[model samples]
Target: MLKEDLKTVNEVSKLTGISVRTLHYYDEIGLLLPAELTESGYRLYDKGNLLKLEQILFLKEMGFELKQIKVILEDPHYDMQKALRKQREILRLKSERLHAIMALIDEKLEGDEYMNFKAFDMKEIERAQEEFKEEVEERWGQTDAYKESAHRTSRYKKEDWQNIMESMNDIFKALACHIGEDVSCKEVQDLIEAWRAHITKYFYECTPEILSGLGDMYVMDERFTNNINQYGEGLAQFMDDAIKYYCLNRL
Candidate 1:
């Protein structure tokens, strides 16, 4: 491709209003790879890359997390046009909610009684959002996973949960034992698969995609990070790297 047909990462960032660091993160996650790399080591984006980045940002606005966005975008049959239309329906629901709130403001401006607070109800809006979430789960491969997870967990008693937590902690602690070791090492990779199997046995079938998402969450979600780190300092990051290595290399 002609060099003139590609824009440097900086230019793409400027045009998208996405910081260079964020763009780099997108690349690191395989979310939005640049179209070309110069011999001097500059990343470049072509028109197709720009379009994919737009879809990524739009999905982020629709409340899909980075991992979810990655999965959706990486789908073999992913249709940008269809995904846009689906998410637009969600925006339409939000717009209707805004109109309801606007009517309440107008009533107050006109000196009408407004203490009933009926317009402030968010049940409809929340339901719409939930339905949209279900649509995503259904369209993706996670609907059965969610349902199976819910069914399996609903029967766990207090002690069962306690035992489960113990096992979970043991796995993390075992993983923590290998801190500073290569994440792709056989021991670490084994631990990672053990982790995946634990989730499937107790929760639901943890597919590689779902497992990968949980790996990202280990560091991205503070709660998960803190919980994992309690097993050992930096264990969260270790778990993240180890799981990521397992997913990318050993899967």
Candidate 2:
């Protein structure tokens, strides 16, 4: 490890503030492997390996599972810069949420009579949702469903959008409460049917094919998954499975 561009595993651990044991575990799991091993069997990481490690850490911080991160990083067409930009946007949204919560806390401390600490402003949440929608459109705008959704939503007023978001959140909360129910059960199916109708009413006519694709996105897209899982643990995957069942059996 005489090379200036190479770092020993211990040095990398110290520099990254990650425990050596964890790094070893990552290596063992094939998530991150050392660039080389010295004659004395010391693990070494080069500059490229360090950059990959940075990406792994960033994704981990963003709540991605280790296996998911590995799949994303190993994809042949993975866009590093795009991923970083998305991560930055996620951090920005989190910062905004934290700021809003802190402001409510401060208002409570100051005895402000108007303070509503029990809930967040739906407007802010809707704004973040709109931003994410725009991002999705930018990435998938060539698809017919994306174009249809954009056209359908083009005339919606702010208040209309707010109502739509509120309705969606309500549905999510209801579904979260029924998490343990079978996806094909009548109650869950009714809720999912209503969800489908809601999407068609607000965005576009969501056909079974389009709805199925959205279900896959719910599980595959981190931003969407995070939003859904906010209602409850495993809620995103649950929603995905329900959507798939609805599309297959009910459609």
Question: How high is the CA lDDT of each candidate model?
Answer: 0.73, 0.72
Question: Model 2 misses residue 50 by how many Å?
Answer: 24
Q: What TM-score should be assigned to candidate 2?
A: 0.45
- Candidate 1, residues 76-153: lDDT per residue as tens digits? 345566777766776787788788789888888999884756666777667766776667767764756655655565
Those runs of model 1 whose alpha carbons end farther than 4 Å from true positions after fitting are 1-142
Give TM-scores for every candidate, taking all chains together and pairing residue i with residue i.
0.49, 0.45
- Give the least accurate 10-residue stretch of model 1, judged by summed lDDT: 70-79
Candidate 1 global lDDT: 0.73
Query: How many angstroms is residue 207 displaced in model 1 relative to the true structure, after the best TM-score fit?
Result: 1.5
Clash number for model 2? Answer: 0
